[model samples]
Target: MGFRQRTMENLVITPAFWQDRRVLVTGHTGFKGGWLALWLQTMGARVIGLALPPATQPNLFELTGLAGQMVSILADIRDRDALAAALASHRPEVVFHLAAQALVLPSYSRPAETYATNVMGTVNLLDAIRQTGCVRSVVIVSSDKCYQPRATACTESDPLGATDPYSSSKACTELVAAAYRSSFFASGDHRGHATALATARAGNAIGGGDWSTGRLVPDAVRAFADRRPLLVRHPEAVRPWQHVLEPLAGYLILGERLYQQGARFAEAWNFGPGGETAHSVADLLTKMAGMWGGGATWRRDDETHPHEAQSLRLDATKAARALPWHPRWPLATALQMTVDWYRAHLDGQDMVAVSRQQIARYCECEPKAVAP
Candidate 1:
């Protein structure tokens, strides 16, 4: 039997699996990383985060009160010495690297910084692993844009390419990771050196506490909060959208499986929602406006923007067949959960509590237990 067929019972991420487990999350200050860090903490894991401070003022890291939950190391991923020192000092068993210059428009202006952060930063981390010898499972989070242009859904084995600086940088990250896996962390009998490395590619991750400019969900939230009509750019651009937790869950499962089973699980994996889940930018914004409710409206912006892919989707068949993974929430449900989170924040609800509540609700395997 394949890996997915071998274990079907304990598909859920159980607290029993995470109790006292040591995890290191790079980019913990970013939107998806913050959510993953908080979720890991709730599962009773010993979590440590390595990244610069939150990029925006109202970042998820601060709003979710994640500082009290994990050890936060403020450092740049491009700094090889600092990154190596953090890894050596923390000595976590599993490492999740999500640090990168992740904005497309910004990359158009700051291409050098984007390449430095996304490409060479990956190189620095893998090199550190060569010296640290304590990590067993490493999940290097890349983007769906790493894949070559495709009319149908892109798969794990698809050719890697890039039409822009941001996408090309991610594509470079993938190549660097593959080279490291083959050269240093090769699956051999070398006991301490055999680290299993895999890359995770996911489409647009949307949820609350995303204060970044130039993102669809955050822009919609800001328009709602400011009581203005949202401006839609690239309205016809299609993307596969999933909740932040969807891919985060996939990462957690992939990490656990890599730690347990080794090289078989060490490869590129796509954690995107199925192709059917993809919708146009206008459709997504319209849905977001509906969820926000009061006087919510949007108009297409005629101003020309930076070059972004016109359409993209993913085929998560390999992940589904190999890792016992599948997206749990449908598009509407994901959108609803996202809208509910921002709404609660606007209503003066404690956002930390709200984030945890959503995590618990998603992992229905366990009732809301007393968080550690």
Candidate 2:
């Protein structure tokens, strides 16, 4: 069916929609998950997080004081029994699955673990939701790398492909979700399965409180803070860089629409920056250095690395056209927000407050819908 661009004055994420809602967020200890959890809390949603312990020492889950704020269950998504138990216990109506082995470089060394986690982990989560039977909406977050690499931006209907273990695992994940939705949670037969599932394919998400190794923004933040030169591996690689909140907003919007609108919004969707906003890694870093002006510097890594894509972008036209969704910040503004967040954390400021402030600021901006 032909889609028309959706536009509205203010985004309709009403408190009435999320208030007192129970949300289950897998991988809540990671960067994006933590931010999403915090945002849900701001909307008065009861959040239950299930994932392995924080991947890093200074992870966002700990820094934002999420443990004290919500019910946190530390367990691996690969453990099917444990995941099922967590879901049965929480009985959440909304499930946002963000748990995965998210790095391309790490996946090369641990291909088995990557697939076990990203692929089976998804299978486990969906099965658990089916077994428990309380979930109404599930937004499975997958990366844009799940798409076959093309010179042009990828749409939701693009043929699935992957170059590395991480990317391939995400592709497998997308397939898994599709199979599950078709076989079990088919929207037409919601009597027994009664779950609506959608996969969110988003671009490279950049923000602070992310200390994952091999990621550009967090590595730059740490190096800049330590007064050391940041290393650039694939400096020429282009990505659709968006703020952390951008896709999270899309995910929430998708989740809400799925709950309210059902089968109409239950499918794969892309939430990514479009056009000139998608920049190269080198250009992104140069702009980030300017935002973080302690004379922060970066040098090209002479060492050889695993095969990574040189050009990747996401076409979020489906989301922009079918729903009230669009990127809220320019790349520069997102970089500045990243720097500002890291600086605030360094000064020993209350990160919970800072994160809330940023989310509020993002929500205040008017969404500019894209043309179909």
Candidate 3:
């Protein structure tokens, strides 16, 4: 059997199986968030987006016209009262918290904003969950940077900490999640309300509709389209690059388990490509350019290098084994699909439908979990 067929044969149950369920996404307008929202909508879920206004020009959220499809709320996760009100109003059965100050270089410049948004924003949202009393499960979207750097692959048991403000804040958010899971939502606590929570640590995700600044794919695509050489900062830096949908499929599965198993499945998990796919920044760019027709060149720009991790990857064996989650698209397929999306968008095609078509391909290939 092919991987998709094998995955389907081993299937126990999956989250996309949920139909018309009330789902709340915190950063619904962001790149990953927008993709997740679109995916959930395809699964027939009632999605509610809670986030501030889009940050940059040509945001993925607006590009896909997501606000019209779901109940979009303009609010900050840092504001405890507002967050609480939204949660209480929606009474979401599943919650995916993706809101935060996510940039690294920007974090260095505005450490306080980064800390406040990433740390306090998490605290506020978790506290809001406590007040809501109806949220059954939560999937907190964290980063591989949250792993305390060591010489080897990081399992969930590895120390939880960060080297920079952005990473450190995510670490703090994980700690807060663990505390909430163990303390209030401990197995037997009546006040705990049986709320299941899981944190997903994914590495660098690249795909279409990602117009964020300081990211590699969008920068390279724009430069190549403009017939200019792409500037490379820290070209030697290695990362665990995967398509945006790969880890996102993992999160949806985690969210499903959180609702079904509650305390039993509450933990942190990693969602990244296997070791062979992990390569340096320059390596990925070279691959991308070659696949897209070869006129692009990269120039080293050390003066503008962002404060990013030198080398980072996630061990997704736990997800693969437990959730029956494996990356559906190979690195080459991921890059090709990503490039195709940008090309279509630039050519004035319907981005939302184009994005949805990609999603359908992925879900068809998504595996069903095997019995433990």
Q: Model 1 scores what on Cα lDDT? A: 0.85
Query: Which stretches of model 2 miss by more than 4 angstroms?
Result: 1-9, 189-193, 369-372
- How does candidate 2 score on lDDT? 0.87
Instruction: Return whichever of 1 and 2 wins on lDDT.
Output: 2
How high a TM-score does candidate 3 get? Answer: 0.92
Q: Compared with the true structure, what per-residue lDDT tens digits does model 1 show for residues 245-326? A: 8899899999988887788899999988778778898888888788778988999899988788999998888887788677
TM-score per candidate: 0.94, 0.95, 0.92
Best by TM-score: 2
Q: Whose TM-score is higher: candidate 1's or candidate 2's?
A: 2
Judged by lDDT relative to the true structure, which candidate is superior, 2 or 3? Answer: 2
Winner by lDDT: 2
User: Can you list the residue pairs that collide in candidate 2?
Assistant: none
Q: Evaluate all candidate structures by whole-model CA lDDT and list the values in order.
A: 0.85, 0.87, 0.82
RMSD to the hidden true structure, all candidates: 5.4, 4.3, 3.6
Over 4 Å off in model 3, which ranges? 1-17, 188-193, 304-307, 366-372
Stretches of model 1 off by over 4 angstroms after superposition = 1-10, 189-193, 365-372
lDDT of 3 by residue, 170-274 (tens): 999899888888876645432345788889999789999887787899899989889788988899987888899988888888888778767666889988886
